[model samples]
Target: MEKRLLDYLQKILNARVYDVAIESRLDPATKLSQRLGNQIWLKREDTQPVHSFKLRGAYNKMVRLSPDELARGVVCASAGNHAQGVALSARRLGCQAVIVMPVTTPTLKSDAVRSLGGQVILHGDSYSDAYAHALELEKKHGYIFVHPFDDPDVIAGQGTVGMEILRQHQHPLHAVFVAIGGGGLISGVAAYIKAVRPEIKVIGVQMTDSRAMLNSVTAGELISLPDVGLFSDGTAVKKVGQETYRLTRELVDDFVTVDTDAVCAAIKDAFEDTRSILEPAGAMGIAGLKQYIAQHNLRGESLVAITCGANMNFDRLRFVAERAEAGEEREALLAVTIPEERGSFRRLCETIGPRNVTEFNYRISHERTAHVLVGISINNRGEVPEIRRSLATQGFSALDLVDDELAKEHLRYMVGGRSQLNANEQLYRFEFPERPGALMRFLSGMHPDWNISLFHYRNQGADYGRILVGIQVPPADLATFRTFIDSLDYRYVDETQNPVYHLFLC
Candidate 1:
């Protein structure tokens, strides 16, 4: 083990990466440090030339190739960060580069490689397909195949990140958190950190849905995942490389698995501290760091997390924003059932008093009762049980849906549609100030005889909130309802006779 580490250390020291990659800044996460009660540092690999640490390894391998190999060119298969890394490296080294990517690869990424002068080939439907095609081309055209994370040269190049981290901070670090996909980054980092600072724990983080390294280590052999989640697509590896898995298993001190929600929250956290949006996989290290500190109840310790990449799809930010609150335990989603009688809904609102309602969806599902899909902001996860207990005190039954993917992703939007039970329902859209008591005041001001048959609201992080509501009233009460709405002085639009409402909800 000593001799093997020595060999890697020598190679890392001699690795050539400065031609295309920079030694990125190690920035302090002040907000995270205060919140977690620990000093948190982020190694900003996302600031590299290709916006990822991949260039370090890609250039290290390509720069070492013989004249004949460089003349023949290099081919690689990548769908994300590594593709750009090789493209940038090959451009800097004055060599022809061919990057094979899945047909489903985003145009943003393929265009990025083309901008760097790499020939782009759109191949099969997945990375594995592109990889096989790249190998075929390599053999046929005498092109050197650049492995993303498997080769010794690549591993040594990535090790320089660890070297930079150690050189940047000489403080007492409790652990160094690294996100793992094929295990290459963590393997190289662990090799260096363990060799120099043996007492500092080298921890690996993986998305729960794509944890090939963790599963492989547990089984004492390589394991292939049948399918991996694509939310953190950068780290969604089916099988870790043989060399990477070996080094990771031997050198890594611990492992943590984080879910999509947690990763989203970490991205939000990173943004709060650094004002930079991190990709899901890039934020996994910070997510795992928080989990570890909380699980062990540790405080005042120093820790480091590598922000690995920033090649995020802009569209994914919407999904990440929606889940970030729940991921950080700042919001609780619940399915609350209440008696369908008049004033029961108001009482339920009173039960959730003083807390900001992040979301609410309801429809008159039955004659005697109603089910509400609600999201309430909370200080911590511990507040969920308290909220549930409060609902029970008011004769309401609440089902915790904070972790229910269906309720969060689909059921919330599908909560109310064409309810036969609400025959007399009149739909209206209302707008009011977005504040703790604003919603309560609206409920309190409604006439007691009027029955609320349906409702939909979502917090848009704006100064005011827009709500869609359905109220059931006798024909005689239409004039009074309009008068009451006018008295409230809130912005509202009458949608009772709208054709779309007639088609979808009436």
Candidate 2:
């Protein structure tokens, strides 16, 4: 190991955090192990007092502070997990703490931080926004800024988790899967593990849409994401820290990205194996582990995943449940067009055979053929193509809607609402910001000249708020409407000409 790397390894070895954090257990996922044909171990950091590994870094860094810095107190910004860590650390250290969080943060997380004796300030819409607000507070109040994952001390503190994992498990570790946000946890873990067990791989996991670190490492330079998905809010960092980026690129063996559905499925996997629920960010490692295992087709080797946090919002479970089956490729959603003539329904069922039907929705159309949405249970993703081919063989056209975000988020719910009364009504799909009053801001942004005929939205705990809107614009105002949309500055798609809209929602 290089001199600087060895120095960090020593810091991780000597970090003091037991005053608050505990040595989380290395529990084996026996059921998952049997299913995957490999030993899968979970580093139970969710069992931390704050229900996250963040406390380790928070307390470790705070304890090392000088008397003057301790007296000055601390402030930091986080989506949720690190806020709780800072809060709990401050409560223990007998110093005041101020946690700045995005207004889009989950209520459960914000409440937890408040209960831990930290003053919670609900600030901007994004972590970058909150960080900016936090910096101002730091300067104004003479508070020490507590970086969530940037500082060497924080990274070293998190490295203790690697130490515990190695000491607890004598079995050869093929890889240690970790979720990366600002890269502190993985950086610390990777540094220690590489110094001590160089042969073992340190893999980093990230949500596909929120993978700033992944993109940066791939580019071989730090990259800033203009926006990030919020399903895994704790790990939705726009940019990784400088030191963390350097360490991660050097120490991490590979990077893997999983989508929202995969994380949802991983959450279900954890619950099934250990009867414990993990948040989306916590489940990221498991999702990446499953993806990696399938990609390499490896078996009989031991692998470890950090089941890092469990501060899940109760309401989010419904969305997680809905997507888990699809994520695991146990379910496939299809849109089928069938003739309105007699025996069409029976023939469709016959074609579907005895496959478990999870969802079936049908609406009569004015056309000769009708569109119906159906979800079928399957053994794996490969079955989707087979089913599509089977439907084609039966003279029915089937469109696989499993990977279609627009279909899953909106079309599935609004397929029955076909309209023809409003002339020149334009259909649009929008990605609104997730912060409070976002809808109001969108509504307010529109000109009164363009009347909103219809609007539908459901929060999925994601960074971008998905909303579908229908507005009436006179043909004469088409150019004005185009200009208005451009001024809105939100990601949007004109769905006015979409066949699905024509079939059911025009």
Candidate 3:
């Protein structure tokens, strides 16, 4: 293992990527360091010319090709970053590059690649599809193929990040966190770090819903995920690379998975420290780092996290901002019901105390009870339970909304009165696949007797479609309704017992 890692480390030390890939700075995350009680160093790969660390691997691999192969051009498939890196490298090397990208790849990224002089071909829905299309093109045109992360040269090139980190910081390090997609970055970094600075841990980070590498590592074999989340679209790979996986199993020290809300909070944290907005995949390292520290109760350790890219879609920032507070436990959302009598509102506010109210929505459900959806600022995660206990002691029925997906995503936006006429309505939150005819399929799959009473949907710049649905089912058809739900393919959660539903639409 040492000999193999040393071989990769030597390749990394000699990787020819500096022609297009600059040495990104290891900047101090002052605010995060102070808050976490650790020295948090951010490897600013977001400052690369193409705004990603991918350039190092892409350029190194392409530059290694013979002049004859270069003249024939190069082809590759990528989610976004590697496409941009290849495009920029091609432009620098005076070679033609054909980049096949998934249709779901953001226009913000595709446009960046095109601006770098690469001929862009929009392919299937995901990177795997694009890779297949690239393979066909590679055969037809006899072009040199540039694999994004599966190739040895790419992994070795990415190892340059570890080399630079050790050079920048001489202090005893705790860990270096790298976000994994197909595992190229971590494979390379782990090899180099373990070979030279074996004391420092090499941690891999992944989005919880799309963790091909983490799942594969756990299973001790490569496994494909049926579907992957697209919120952090850059790392939404469904399969891990074989070579990358082998390297990871032997070299990586730990792996952590974080959710969308946590990644959003990490993006906000990055901005607070450096005034730079990173894409969801880029902020994953910091998110996982925060989670690891909390789980392990570690403090005063020196750590580094690679902020890998900044090609964030502008439209996605609104959604990130909405969930960031909840992820950081900076805000607590609640559904509180109060009697419709006079002075009830004032009494509710008094019960809430002087805490800053972040959001408030109120609507009368009936002549007796009114539901109020409110968001309150809190100092930490502990404050949530304290606030809930306080409300309980004051005879107010409060439902914590921090972990309620239905309430946070859709219910808070809609505050209409209960259906006085409809009978036996059941509420559900569904994650519809982001494809054509999804809504039609959902409608067709339902039984005619189950009428959809209430519905709300808004695209959160993610792969899946989220909708809050209320259906009227007669008491006799309860069994049939449950059977129909079990047959449907989409992921769903029953929200009928949710206090927010009772308050707003029961």
Candidate 4:
């Protein structure tokens, strides 16, 4: 082990990566430090030319190729950052580059490779399929295959990140957090860190659903997962590289498995400090770091997390934002039951006073009681039980839905439909400037004589709050109800006559 570590140390010292990669900044996260009571530093590998640390390994491996091999060019299979790295490296070396990506890969990623002068081939629906096709091409066309994580040269190139970190921060560091996928980055980082500063712990971070490395280490052998989750697609590897598995097991001090929600929260944390978004796998290190600090109850010690990549799909930001609060225990989802009486709904609202409601979905389900799916903004996890107790005191039964996957993804939106108690009900859509008390104020201002039959509201991170509401009003009072709505000055559209409403909600 000592000999192997020294060999990698020398290789990293001599690695040629400056041709395409940058020495990314190691910026301090001041806000996080203040909140967590730990001095946190981010190794900004996302600042690489391809917005990923993959370039360091790709360029390091390619620069040493023999003249004839360089002439033959190279090929690689990657669904994300690694593809961009090899493409950009081949461009700098004036070599032909062919990138094989799964057909399911987003066009944004494929187009990025093309923009870097790499030929793209969209193959089957998954990385395994694309990888098989790339191997076939390598044998058929005599192209050098640039393995993403397995090769010695590639690992050495990635180790340069560790070398740079040590040189940049000679101060006392308690631990270094690294995100692990097929394990190249962490293996390389662990190798260098352990060799040079053995006392400083090297920690590996992996998503709970795709923890091949962690499982392999635990089993004392390589293990292949039957499947992996796609939330952190970059790190969703079924099997880790053999070389990487060995190095990680020997050099890494510990491993932490984080869930998708925690990764989403970590992404939000990075954005807060740097005003930049991170891909799920890229933010895994930060998630692990926070977990470590909490579990160990450590404070005031310096720690580092590698911000590895930032090639995020724009559409995923909404899902991340929706789950981030839950990950940090800052939001609570509940199913509350209240008596189906005239004043019970109002009482429930009064009990929940002051706290912002992130979401609310309700329909008159039974003649005796009504069930509500509501989301409330919270300060921490401890607030959940307190809120439940408060609801109980008001004669409402509350079920915590914060960790319920079905409740969060599907049931929340499926809470309303046609009801037998909807007699004389009229539907309306209203848009008002969004603020903390918007929903509560609307409910309080409603006429006491009117009964609410259906209600749906979700915070979309938009400037305006849009809600769909159904109110039961007597036919004789239709004119007065219209006048009342007009007086509120909120933008409103009557959905009572909409064909879709009749089909789905009436």
Query: For residues 135-202, what per-residue lDDT tens digits would candidate 4 score against the true structure?
Result: 99999999999988989999999999999999999999999999998889988888899989999999
Which ranges of candidate 4 are over 4 A from the true structure? 418-506
TM-score of each: 0.82, 0.96, 0.92, 0.82
State the C-alpha lDDT per candidate.
0.85, 0.90, 0.89, 0.86
Q: Roughly what TM-score does model 2 have, to 2 decimal places?
A: 0.96
Give a tens-digit lDDT track for model 1, residues 1-506: 49999899888889998888899999999999998899999999989977889998999999999989899999998867889999998888899999998765656678899999999998864566778899999999989999989999999899999999999999898999999987778888888988888999999999998889999999999998876665676787888899999999899999999998999999999999999888888999999999999998989999999999887767668778988988999999888889989999899899999999988888775788778878898999999999999999999998887875545654578666776688678777876655467788888988888899987886543234658888998888889888988877666778777544552366
Cα displacement (Å) at residue 249, model 3: 1.2
lDDT (C-alpha) at residue 99 in model 2: 96
Model 1 TM-score is 0.82
- lDDT order, best first, reads 2, 3, 4, 1
The better-scoring model by lDDT among 1 and 3 is: 3
| Highest TM-score scorer | 2
Q: For candidate 3, list the clashing residue pairs, or say none.
A: none
Candidate 3 has a TM-score of 0.92
